[model samples]
Target: MKEIVAVLGPGSWGTALSMVLDENQHEVRLWGVDSKQIAEINTEHTNKNYLPETQLSDGIVGYTDLEKAITGATYILFVVPTKAIRSVAKQVAALLDGKTKPVLIHASKGLEQETHKRISVIIEEEISSDLHDGLVVLSGPSHAEEVAKKDITTITAASGTDEIAKKVQKLFINHYFRVYTNSDVIGVELGAALKNIIAVGAGALHGLGYGDNAKAALMTRGLAEISRLGVAFGADPLTFIGLSGVGDLIVTGTSIHSRNWRAGNLLGKKVPLAEVLESMGMVVEGVQTTKAAYELAQQKGIEMPITEAIYRVLYEDADIDEVIRDLMMRDRKAE
Candidate 1:
């Protein structure tokens, strides 16, 4: 059955996902804050700034009006940055004041800075449960550029309930795009968010002229700390080995398409954090996530050396080389 889906955020990932829904024969309304971009998407059938090479589908419409974009949609996919999730959810909740609830699915990955809350927790806190059926997280190693070109990609749709996760699985699954359902929402989300931090470290290693052996070692040890902190926060350790975990870490850490990796790469070349952010012109989620994770680890008394090292590089202006030296000098321990 065809459904009306609202994809909020006109970024590359959101635009790519809108294309996916269009491929599934659903009516997609892509909502964004920029009216010019929205008009371009509606009239020109392209989002040059984001998906410059791909042509958008006719079935997908762009909207700047938040209420109109979501008014009658049966599903809402929030693809905005983590920082914007709360405000967007509040707006959606207000728009759905007395209307039927829609299924809420988010693809953003990050932990809230000060509060250290997950994306779903932020959304749930702002939007009353009455206005939404359930919260689901769609995550994996899939990249927007590859997905836009119809590349084979697999991801996970996780919710507290199997029924909700399966519902999302059906909504997105297709030949080139495979969707798996997982009941470990906490694990899935943590794996999705935490892997980006490791990716930054991976990119930094590359930027510093590190060879395959060093990169391999970094990834192996990075996953260890990620799983350690994740387990401390009540996430299943096995999820880290799955798509949202090791899978995401591999792609995000290695792929040039990843904004976080790119940012770290620039940092490795001795670029300032502000300069890197300005040059990229997109959110580098791992930077903020590193800070949040470091804080969370300290608060929870969890040992996460890689996360702490990245935090020092990003926040404390520590020299990347010195940080690497300190990391290497740490006492040896069993894997």
Candidate 2:
């Protein structure tokens, strides 16, 4: 069934997802704050600054007005950064009609910096239940750059309710983009957010001229750390092995397309955090996620050495080399 999908953000990921909706024959209303980018999307059918070298589908209309983009939409997809999710959700809630309840789906992956709340939680808190159908989290190993080019990408659309998850799956499932459904929203959201922290560590390993063996160790240990913290939060342990878990960890940790990985690579070279962020010209979510995860792990009494090492380096101004050394020198324990 054709539906009006309002994609909020208009960043690379949002635009790429919009392309998928366009291919599915849906009316895509892409909303963003930047007038120039919105105008470019409307007129030139391109968003070079974000998704460079990729031409967007002409059918994907861009809108600067929040109300105009989502007034009649059946689904509202939030792709904004973690920091902006609450603010954006509030804005959407204010403009949405009381009688209209669109299915709320978020592709953004990260816990809120201040509250350490998942994207879905923040959205639900901001948007009244009467104003939306249900909340679903769409996440996996898919990158915006690859998805923009129609590369074969598989992901998970997860919701507490199976029906809601399946609804999202049907809309995005097609050639080159496969969508799977999962009932574990907690696991899905955690895996999606926690992997970014490890990706930064993996990139740092590469930046430090470490061999594949070192990266493998870091990622392996990183997964265990992620799973430990996740389970503490009441997430299904099995979900950590699925697409949003180890799969997402691999892609984000290894791919150059990951902003977190790129940021980590720069950090590994001993570059200052502020300068690295300024140079990237994009949100390095892991930088903020690391702090939240670190604090959360501590609060939960979860043993997450890798997360702690990255946290120390990111937040405490610790030497990367010394942190790595301390991590390696920790007492032996069962694998």
Candidate 3:
């Protein structure tokens, strides 16, 4: 089945997914905002800025022009960062043909900074109501680098429409990369964003020389907070117990590959947050997402102590020991 697929973003995850789709025998066009990166991948078939060492698929064509990429796209996979999701969504909307319907698969995580909306929400606002039902959010524990290596990874393809979900599943699922269908859009999106905050918490603990016990405790309690906020946002609680929730938590919290966790690790090691991020050359979503989550919690009256602690540490320059003390001294409650 040769389907035309356009992936919007030239970052590691976008490139890796494009490679996967290419291997699956789909014609893929990789699009990005960065002209140099698009030119590099288009000419050399490699993302030197992101995934430097991995080999890209020959069938994958890279394009910086959004119009060129989305011209004949049947299924569009959005792989851009969360902060840029809306801007890219608007670009996509402008270039979208009113006649040719495309199933939108949102592969990015994190809530919108401006409207506090999810990527799927932004897409729904841009595309026609007819296409709104086709918006899908794809997420899991898979990391971009490992997926680029052809490692076995399982992910979820969630949408309001089962027909669209099936289409996405057929297009993306492979022997090494398995894509399952999920109906819980809020759960999947929330799980993806919330995991980064917990990953930062876990990474901070690791940087502070805490063992697995502390990390596990953070993960469990973090999921509780995640569930609380998610339920407030209309997500099914059980969805948090699935791959996008617990699975993503385990992977991001434990893996050194996670940029959010890595950033927190540096912060724990006594480096300034700005300095750490500047050195990484990549976006550590947790930093921005923490501020967003903190605001949401305050507005919704949600209790997220761990997130607050990280927020204070980042914003107020709170003493780490005192921050830990505040978390530990909280009134005990049932689990």
Write down the TM-score of every candidate: 0.99, 0.99, 0.97
Task: List clashing residue pairs in candidate 3.
Answer: none
lDDT of each: 0.92, 0.94, 0.87
Instruction: Report the C-alpha lDDT of model 2 over 124-199, residue by residue, as the tens digit.
Output: 9999999999999999999999999999999999999899999999999899999999999999999999999999
Candidate 1 error regions (>4 Å): none
Candidate 1 vs candidate 3: which has greater TM-score? 1
RMSD of 1: 0.8
A best-first ranking of the candidates according to their lDDT comes to: 2, 1, 3
lDDT of 3 by residue, 218-242 (tens): 9999999999999999999999999
Which residue runs does candidate 2 get wrong by more than 4 Å? none
Candidate 2, residue 23: the lDDT equals 95
Cα lDDT of model 3 overall? 0.87
Q: Locate the minimum summed-lDDT window of 10 residues in model 2.
A: 92-101
